[model samples]
Target: MLFLLSPAKSLDYETPVPAEVPATIPHFEAPRGPSTELIRLLREKSPQQIATLMHLSDNLSALNVARYKAWSGRSTPENARQAAFAFDGDVYGGLDARSFTPAQLDWAQAHVCILSGLYGVLRPLDLLQPYRLEMGTALANRHGKDLYAFWGSRIADHLNERLAADRTPVVVNLASQEYFRAVDRKALKARVVECVFEEWKTDRYKIVSFHAKRARGLLARWAVLHKAATPRALEKFDLEGYGFDAEASAPERLVFRRKT
Candidate 1:
């Protein structure tokens, strides 16, 4: 994962990739991970204080949440997934978490996965901003449930603007599905944002997104698991296109302009 710190080095991948902003995105590339002092400050502060800090200064931003937290090689994106799997298959979850319900996890995972939103584990740098700002604002307002809802809305807006600027398709997560579906969609002919996930057993779950009404015959049924799971190392996965696991749970739905 340390190698991912330099975006230039990461650009050599074979797949067509999203335009990145290395500085802003959180990855495995910080000077000291996180300091003990920072975690103490965060733990002591109220959510409102955290939110205010997020909006006012970069010093105590939400991105700092996982700075010092430790991750094993399985979750590190280092040590090549194959080796991690060979050594500790259960840790990295080669089959993806979709096989289990979010409710079934332990306190730590519930805090990290459900509450902390994986603390920028798999997300890219540029993509983190919209969600970060949205979460910060919502936390400040004390509208907790609305965090995801508001995040979805703001992300949808950001995606709309990015799409209009370029006709490029990129990888996104299930967390943003509700948001993307809320777009008014001004003039971007190519409206696809490939969603990457892990099915229960294994492999990336692929979701193809577009204006649901317009996608009609282009993708056959409204939803289906077109690409099955993959075996081998983590790098063996294909992350460059539209995909989703139809067999998994229902994605969060985003309602756009409502009609009577």
Candidate 2:
């Protein structure tokens, strides 16, 4: 089984990663190809323009502008860190990759895939340079109006390649809607299963953004720890007060609810 996740905007490169988890090269390079073109377009824009485009403060915009300028095509352990270790958003907080053992990381490296605006698709151990370009950004590129247009069928094709190597070849989509939209479902050969995490609110079960995001990471963590290879194994996931709701779940969409 393969898992899909969204890249985080918040980064934590300074935090020391576990010495056992060795960093590897990203499956695809952004600096040399279409991603390079996107960066080129970004370089043309001023910090103020960037702030306006991404809705960032002056300081954040300045920081990203420096990051964009410093982003050389070449990535090394000295210059870049692994995607899993670099990200520190809510989803990543639950993932807590820094605590994982090398063996667990090895399992994750094969099963987990992180979708990105600049990098397109990344494996867990893939080396990444710091930059903030969300998948939903409206940055016009040569392909069309947005990053989606530029990525087109490329991401889907890459997923297919990864799935072809897997025995089960099922995609567990833990990414948010905005990031998942980048993947061309029709182009993919593997069966896609969307995981939904909901909370029992006043009236009924509903998806709370923050809790659901963390739950997604928890599920990913479960998969890696258990070395889950089948879709059925996913339903057994029970962590952080979440339990699989068989009645609420469908074949394509697995629902896990927490009564908190």
Candidate 3:
């Protein structure tokens, strides 16, 4: 089973990566790559345009504008950090890639895939540069008026290729709906399973954005540390205070609930 995750908007490029962790190039950043094409378009937008497009403050808009201008065609150790370590948000907070050992990171690199607006799909160890682009962004490109239209079936095709060797070829969807929408379901060749994390709010179990995001990361972390390969193994996930809700789970949707 391959686990899907969403890229965090908040980034941490200041921390030093461990000497043991290695980085690889993103698939979409190859020569004449999709990312390169997208970057070319992003470079055209002025800081004010970016601010309006992404609804950012002056400071944030200027920062990203500079990032777009400074982006290089090639990723280097000096310019990039591993994707898992670079992302810093609620989802990544639970992931806590910093604590992972070299062996665990190696396993995560193969089993985990992070959905991105710019790079498409990123493995845990893929080299990443600092940037802020959400999947829902309406960045017009040759493909269409939005990033989703631009991505089309490319994301699903990539996932299919990666799952070709797997016996079951199951895709565990831990990504937010915005990012997951980029993966064309018709083009994908795997059984997609959605994991729902709910919290006991007031009188019932309800989904909270912050807690759910962190739970997704916790689940992903559990899968990596345990080396969970089968869907059955995932049901056994009981990290943080969460417990699998057998009654609430369906064949395609697995629900985990927690009471705090």
Candidate 4:
């Protein structure tokens, strides 16, 4: 089921975009690391001891014991696959058990969307891991189709940021090939237009970006385009038809025609 909201009353469907956000990212908290006590303890313990504690914490403190165990199986692969899965599970896929009545569970569907809003806060590949079945089941039951839509919209917003300015506004960085392939390129571009115009309903920003790239070389353009039905009129999402070969990269951004 698609989530629906009324378009802004003033949008002409010709020019729409969320108030542009500052190019600079706001400062965030310090990165994660062992606490002082944990660091001390690690110094005193061996690798086996450290792994034992970690395993115990994860194994014993989980929400659904049976489901978590089943998902993990008798043993872990202990290689690239295992590490990749572990990283993915850390944010978007993992156990978060809870007991609630049918109504409560239904509400959680939206609140705990995509295995607990992990997809929103985390990278896309983070969802492609071994998740606790109990938690995933809850999310799927609650959202139906809204979860996927919400997830798509989130990525689309990110794409807007990457494409909102000059063809080479900041940098061309892709943490992983998986990131670029995270979503359907064409559909994601379309969704970016929808999300930007939707947010524009309130915020008073002007210009925005719509990224696209295809093949080795293509036009990387960001013109003030038009949207449909939404409040703004100048919302554009047609990369290929405009002579720009579009290939979705990290967060599914559309790459531009390479420079000569």
Highest TM-score among the candidates is held by which one? 3
Query: In model 4, where is the ten-residue run with the lowest total lDDT?
Result: 21-30
lDDT of 2: 0.90
Question: What C-alpha lDDT do the candidate models reach, one value each?
Answer: 0.26, 0.90, 0.93, 0.24
Backbone-clash count (model 4) = 35
RMSD of candidates 1 onward, in order:
16.2, 1.2, 0.8, 20.4
Alpha carbon lDDT at 152, candidate 3: 97
Which model, 3 or 4, shows the larger lDDT? 3
- Model 1 lDDT on a 0 to 1 scale: 0.26
- Candidate 1 residues lying further than 4 Å off, grouped into runs, are 1-22, 25-145, 168-260
Clashing pairs in 3: none
Write the candidate numbers in order of decreasing lDDT.
Answer: 3, 2, 1, 4
- Ordering by TM-score: 3, 2, 1, 4
Better of 1 and 2 by TM-score: 2
Candidate 1 similarity to native, TM-score = 0.25
In Å, residue 110's CA in model 4 sits off its true spot by 29
What is the Cα root-mean-square deviation between model 1 and the actual structure? Answer: 16.2
Scored by lDDT, the top model is 3
lDDT of 3 by residue, 130-149 (tens): 88899999999989999999
lDDT of 4 at 49: 46
Model 2: per-residue lDDT, tens digit, 146-208? Answer: 889989999999999988877657999999999999999889888999999999999899999
